[model samples]
Target: MRRRLRVLVTGAAGLVGAEVTARLAAAGHEVTALVHRTPVLVGNDGTPLEAAGVRCLTADVTRPRLGLSEADHEALAGGIDRIVHCAAITDFGRPEEDYQRVNVDGTAHVLELARAGGADLVHVGTAYVCGERDGLILETELDEGQRLANAYEASKLRAETLVHKARADGVRSAVVRPSIVVGDEHTGVVRDYKNIYVVLKLTTEGKVRSIPGQYEARLDLVPVDYVADVITQVTERFDEAAGRTFHAVGAPLTLRDFSDVMAEYPSFQVPRFVPPTSFDLGRLPREERVYYERVVALYESYFRRRMAFDASNTAQLVARPAPGGGQDFLRRLIDHCLESGYLGAPLPGVADVLARLDLTGADVSGPAANDANGAGR
Candidate 1:
């Protein structure tokens, strides 16, 4: 028989967090949800989490030590047996300092909560923490000190450091790194509007005139549900799983192929996957280079990286393989987002108030437009 567990989940309203929390609840584990703000969306029951047997607590994750009042901290520490940390800034373009504060320092604070509760910690990290373009990114391997393309990776690396240190301090911790998470394979419901969705929307909005290549650059994407499933399954084996990291990535799918599926949407055209050297940057005027950078920065950042995410640990531990990858998966994802009205959804009225225009670019592939630090994980 298994012990009934009390689990606290950070980033409870996030895409992955929502799914994982729901799964955990379904398994009869008590779940405590920590949200950054007023929690509107609830679990699968279409009501408040408390109604679903979850204790919902609201706090800013970026606060020093999570800004928890004594009552809140004691409330968190008293009954929690495990913590699933899904909070972190995922946007690659956020200022390095901001990323460090949230992804790195924020993780330490979450660890503190877990420590106070004597709970095993499960942290959701990204596979890109493997760092800039190189060779195989192994699941069990880490901290080769790989060069980072942006701040997001750097901060996550710092966060991973914090979690590992906690493990060393007897926190009984484990980390999961997912690469390019997409929508559900069966349902095609994706709330994330960044990453590939940005590119697809731009194409439909006519931001891109030419793809410049056959879109053949190999890309990787994994389904979110699959990741949630793996997280749930792995957390159950905490004693052996502690201190381990697993990569939730699918088999390699090329960018061109990704676009082919995405282009099925009215806005996106099949990408041109010409070799990077095939296009001469010098031919463009100074301003065009800047403009081109805005238009293609996201694509460039991802396509420029050349490596495979090897998830042997994920496969071995979860007994599942990445589902619905490559071209078909991409098209289905784009279609779902478009039909769901997520792509190019009107910014909320307060976007002007909260909008960080300094971080946005005119091009679709530019930095994130909303709050998500990055796309799926």
Candidate 2:
């Protein structure tokens, strides 16, 4: 039997936070979900947090003492046993000031809350805090003189630095860095479809046909549930998790594999990969050039980096096996997109097309067959 403790989760309305909050409440813990503008907390699998007995408190992370009233703050400080700091601006290309205020300063405020409550802290960070680099990234490594790719990564690094400083000052803290978070492993259901999904939407819609990237660049995609699981485990087993870092990451897939998988879907348009050095956006069609410049260009770093996260600590602590990142999984993601109408209606399958052709007495042989097969590709 596990002891139920009072736990406070910031950003409870966000993806990972909601899942963590739901899990804690379901496990019989007294969970307080702190939210800002988005007060409704829904787990990754679409479970309402409140219905699971989660108490949602409206507050701003960017504000000191989490913008709570004095009485509320005192009550939280007195009763809370653990604080899971999940509030952070995760979007890329945000203004540096926004990142600093939300991610950096917000973390500082959360630390103060932890200090007041004498609560163990479980901070959610990103594996990309290792920055724009290749090869292996260890959990013990931070600030290896690698250049950061965006303001979001830089802000997370700074926030982690604060956590490390607090740990040195005797705050029981642990950092869990999750790589690119995606849908669930089995159902492929995601709460939100941002990040890589944006570029995926553009490419699959034929809005962007050519992208500048290396064929072998790797993308590490971890399931949202796994990340939440890691966070919840660390919170529950604080004694063993203190003063350590864990990577909640999944297996990685290469750009070639991604392209091949997209090509397998007859409704998906596979983007052509061109080396960054020789690629010129000016040569693209007008509409493609617009989409590339406005949307796809923002995600260029993700398409070029081949960074691998080493999750030795996570492997030791987490009992769940790492989720698969193969063709079938990719297909599952795409299938969900089609089913949810996120990608609009999918085109008819080859067999369906063949049946229609038979009814119309049209040829399904030679060049016509090849043309039908190559419709989306």
Q: Evaluate all candidate structures by whole-model CA lDDT and list the values in order.
A: 0.70, 0.84
Tens-digit lDDT track of model 2 for 252-327? 8889989999888787788888788877765665555566777787678888998888888888888888777676
- lDDT score for residue 170 of model 1: 75
lDDT by residue (107-188, candidate 1, tens digit) is 9888888888788899999998887757787877678867777778878888988888787677888889988777777666
| Predicted model with the maximum TM-score | 2
**Which residue segments of model 2 deviate by more than 4 Å?**
344-377
Model 2 per-residue lDDT at 62: 93
| Clashing residue pair totals per candidate (backbone < 3 A) | 20, 0
TM-score of 1: 0.81
